[model samples]
Structure formats: C-alpha cells, structure tokens
Target: MRIITGIYKGRHFDIPRTFKARPTTDFAKENIFNVLNGYIDLEDAIALDLFSGTGSISLELVSRGCQSVISVEADRDHHAFIKQCLKKLGTDRCIALRGDVFRFIKSCHQQFDFIFADPPYALPELPTLPKLILERGLLKPNGIFVFEHGKNNSFEDVPGFIEHRAYGSVNFSIFSNREPEGEDE
Candidate 1:
C-alpha cells in the first residue's frame, strides 16, 4: 500500500504476504481524508490507531502531518513490520506498541484527537469497542473515534454516533465524545 497524498504522497510499501491486514483501499482513505480536511488540521492533531495491522493508517497520518500517533498492534509479526516500516519511513512521530488494543485503551492515561480501529471482521465483540473507548476516556473533548468494520456491521444506534460513512465494503462508524446530559458527568 502507498500514501495517496501529503508529504509522503506516492511513497509505497510492499506488505509481505505473511501480513494478515487488509489495508484500507487508497480510494477510501483518500476520500475519508478529504472529508476530514474541512474539519481538522492534521499538524495540530494527535491520533491513535488500534489494531494497527499494517501501520498504513498511522503512516498516512504522519505523512499528512499529525503531531503524533500511538499505533498499537498485538501480533508479533505485525508489530515488527510496523516498527520496520516506521524506521524506513523516518517516522519518530509514531509510537508503536505491541499489546492488546483493548488493554492498551484501559491502561492509557492519554487522549487522542482522533482514533481509528480496524479489528478483524470475524471478531464478534467489535460492536462494543466504542463503548469500551468511552468508558476508558480515550478521546479528547470533541475527539473522534472511527471504527472500520465490514458491510454487515452497523453502529448507527450507538450513543455518540455522529456519522456512518461507507466506501464499498469498508464502513466507518464515527463516534464523538457525547455531550453529557446533566452536571457534565
């Protein structure tokens, strides 16, 4: 996969066949970023990428000039590949961690301007990720959490859901920090 825009535009990485990630399609990624462009300044943003699979999203964020990105992946090989990719890309802005995404969220004292999660499609617990993130307070005030899932999944009924964007088989359910009902929680 390659970065489709920004400073690293046109740079490509050959993901080994052993890698199990289904990297976001360039078309989808570009479209998503275009939509985001109107709202956020990448250089002013801090991001978190859960299940960082191939590190593609993190790299794209860096390429687009995010202030920092914490990218977490549990697979040993995937973690190694991400590390190697970061080194080759000269990216010190990304913090790569080898750990369970859920556990990381629970333990983190940090909050991100944007968080992207792309869990395996077969994982039955995907629906609960947004709730988990909220319980752990992983997002900054007004931050966004974008979960990428398969066509069959739907998060529209979820609390804090702001929008659902689709590009063919890829679906992004976006949740923002909910406005507290009373007393500011």
Candidate 2:
C-alpha cells in the first residue's frame, strides 16, 4: 500500500507475506480521508487505530499531520509491518502496539480525538464496539469514532451513531459526540 497524501505521500510498504490482515482499499481510503479533511484539524488530533491491520489508516492519519497515532494490532506480522512502515517513513509520531484490540480497549484509559476500529466483519461481537467505547469514555467530548465494516451490517439503530457512509463494498459507520445545531436544550 502507499501513503495517499501529505508530506509522506507516494511512500510504499508491502504487506508481509505472512500477514493475513485485510487492508482498506485505495478507493475507500481516498474517500474516507476526504470526509475527514472536512471536519478534522489533523495537527491537533490524537488518533487510535484499532484492529489496525496493515496500519493503512494510521499511516494516512500521520501523513495528514495528526499529532500522534497509536496503532493496535494483534498479529505479529501485521504489527511488525506497521512498525516497519513507520520506520521507513521516518515518522516518530506514531506508536505501534501488539495486543488484542478488545483487551487493549478495556485497559486503555487515555482519550483520543479520533478513534477508528475496523474489526473482522465476521466477528459476532461487532455490534458492541460503540457501546464499549462510550462506556469506557475513550473518545473526547467532541471526538469521533469510525467503525469500518462490510456492507452486510448497518449501525443506524445504534445509539450515538451519527452517520453512515458507503464507498462501494466498503462501509463506514461514524459515531460522534456533537449535537447538531438547533437541537433541543
């Protein structure tokens, strides 16, 4: 995969042969960042990338100037690939951690300005991620948590769910902390 934009744009990294993680496609990524560009002040944000896979999202965040990014991955190869990418990009702004995402979520107490979770679509517990995050106060008061999933599932009924967007077969559910303008007191 390649860094799509910013100072590190055009950089490339290979997904290790041993890595079984599925990466977000370039098409979806471009669109995601486009949306992010509208609401995010990249330099002021702290990002968390859970179920990090090949770290595409993290790298993209870093490229766009996020202050710091914590990438969490469980697989050894996948985690290593993230570290490798950071090193290659000469980015000291990101932290790559190897651990189970669920366990890591329970253990982490620090809050982030943005949190992105792209868990395995087939995982039965997928529906609970937003609740888990809210219960733990992982997102800042006005932060966003984006969950990427396959097209088969929809989060429209889930509380705190603000918006859902689809880019081809890739889908994203956005949860936010801000109330819309002109809402009730």
Candidate 3:
C-alpha cells in the first residue's frame, strides 16, 4: 500500500501475505481525500480510524497533518504491523490500539473531528455502525464520518448520511454530526 499525499506522499509499505485485512484501494483513498480536502482542513482535525487494517488511513491522516489520530484494530498481527508502521513514520500523533472495534466505540468518551471505519464487508453489525457512532456522539459537531464497505451496502436512508461516493467496487457513505438547522430529526 502507499501513502498518497502530504509529508509521506509516494511512500509504500509491503503488507505481509498472511494479513487477511483488506486495505483500501489507493485510487479510492486518493479520491476520498480529494473530496474531503474541499470540506475539512486536515491540519486541524483529530481523527479516528476503526478496523484500522494496515493502518493505511491512519497513516495517511498523520501524513496530512491531522492533529491526532487513534487507530483501533482487532487482530493481533494487524495491530503489530500498525505499530511498526507508526514507529517508522516517526510521528507522535497517532495512537494504535489492539482491541475489538465495537467495544472500543462503546467505551470511547473522546470526540473526533473526523472518523473512518472499514470493517469486513460480511460483518453482520456493519449496518449499525453509523447509528451507534451518531447516537453516542462520538463525532464532535460538524465532524465527518466515512464508512467504507462493499457494493452490497448503502446508507442513503441513514439519518446522518450526507453523501455516498463510489470508486470501482469500493463504496463510502459519508456522514456529518451536525444536521442543518430546521431539518427534521
């Protein structure tokens, strides 16, 4: 995988073949960030990355100068790889944790300016994530959440959903914590 922009632009990491986690496609990731750049200032954002496979998104956040990032991964080897990647990046801005994504979300009290989740497409709890995060107020006012999934899922009817973007087979449903004034709840 590669870091597409900012300080770490063009940097690449060789993920081990044993890793089962699917990293985001570089094309989709680049396009997603391009869109995000129009709305959010990455330099000032505090971000969260869930099911942080290979820590690609988290690393990209740090590279782009996000204020801080918390990356949560459930698997043992995946977590280890993330740590190693962080160490090599030489930045104190990201905190990598090894734990269940759902449990972490439940216990997390801190809010973020940006959040990204890329869970396994087949995971049964996928549909509930957007609501869980929104209801729990994990995202600060005006914060954006980007949930990545396969072509089978759609978040158009979801309350906080702002827009949906697709790149090949990758799908991203974007949500915002702040609803417009006078809009229905």
Candidate 4:
C-alpha cells in the first residue's frame, strides 16, 4: 500500500500475506482526499478511523496533519501492523488501538471533527453505523463522517447523509452534522 499525499506522499508499505483486511486502493484514497482537502483544514482535525486496516487512512490523516488520529482495529495482527507502521512513520500523532470498533464507538466520550468507517462489507452491522454514530452524538457540529462500503449498500436516505461518491468498485457515503442554513431555532 502507499501513502498517496501529504508529508508521507509516495511512501509505500506491504501488508503481511497472512492478513485479511483489505486496504483502500491508492486511486480511490487519492480522489477521496482531494475532496476532503477542499473542505477540512486537516492540520487541527481530530479524527477517528474505524476498522483501520493496515492503518491506511489513519496514516494518511496523520501525514495530512490531523492533530490526532485514533485508529481502532479488532484484529490483533492488524493492530500490531498499524503500530509498526506508525513507528516507521516516526510520528506521534496517531494512537493505534486494538479493540472492537463498535465497542469503541459506543463507549467513546470525546467528539471528533472527522470520522471514517471502512467495516468489512459483509458485516451485518454495516447499515446501522450511521445511525449509531448520530444517535451517540460522536461528531461535533459540522463534523463529517465518511463511510466506505461495497455497492450492496446505500445510505442516501439516512439523516446527515449529504453526498455519495463512487470510485470504481469502492463506494463512499458522506454525512455531516452541519445544521441546514437559516434554521437556528
């Protein structure tokens, strides 16, 4: 896998052959970042990466200058690899956690500026994550959540869902907590 942009742009790493998590494709990651770059000021953003396979997105967030990135991966091996990658990057901006993403979500007390979830497409709970995050108020006002899934799912009708983008076989549904214009009451 490769770090597509930011300070670590073009950096490459290999996933252990025994691993099962699928990292996001570099092409898709690049395009997604291009979109994110237009909106978020990454330098101070506090971010969370769920199902952080290979720590790909987490690393990108750090390299792009997010103030802090918390990466949660349930697999022990995957979590270890993430820590190794973070060490190799020589940065103290990311915290790699080995735990269930759902448990972390339910128990997390801190709000974030950005959140990204890339759960296994086959996960039965995939469809419910948006509501779970919203109901839990995990994102600060105007915060964004990007959900990556296979084409089998659609979240356009879900509250907070603002846009959808498809990059080849990978699909992303973006949600935001921004209040609609002119409705302060």
RMSD for all candidates, in order, please. Answer: 2.6, 1.6, 2.0, 1.2
lDDT of model 4 at position 183: 68
Prediction 1 global C-alpha lDDT = 0.87
Candidate 3 residue lDDT tens string, 28-49: 9999999898667889699999
10 residues in a row with least lDDT, candidate 2 = 35-44
Cand. 3 TM to true fold: 0.96
| The best candidate in terms of TM-score | 4
What are the per-residue Cα lDDT tens digits for candidate 2 across 1-185?
98899888988887867677879999998998788766666775999999999999999989988899999999888888899889988888899999999899999999999999999989898888878987788988778888998888888877778888899888998887765677777
TM-score of each: 0.93, 0.93, 0.96, 0.96
Rank by TM-score, highest first: 4, 3, 2, 1
Compared with the true structure, what per-residue lDDT tens digits does model 4 show for residues 1-185? 98887899888889999999989998899898888776567788999999998899999999988999999999999999999999999999999999998899889999999999999999999999998988899998889899999998999989998888899999999998987789657
Weakest 10 consecutive residues, lDDT, candidate 1? 176-185
> Which has the higher TM-score value, candidate number 3 or candidate number 4?
4
Q: Please give, for residues 83-114, the per-residue lDDT of candidate 1 as tens digits.
A: 98889888799999999987898789998888
Score each candidate by Cα lDDT.
0.87, 0.88, 0.92, 0.91
Candidate 3 Cα deviation (angstroms), residue 170: 0.3
> How big is the positional error of residue 31 in model 3, measured in Å on the Cα after superposition?
0.5
Checking candidate 4 for backbone clashes, the offending pairs are none
| Residue pairs in collision within model 1 | none
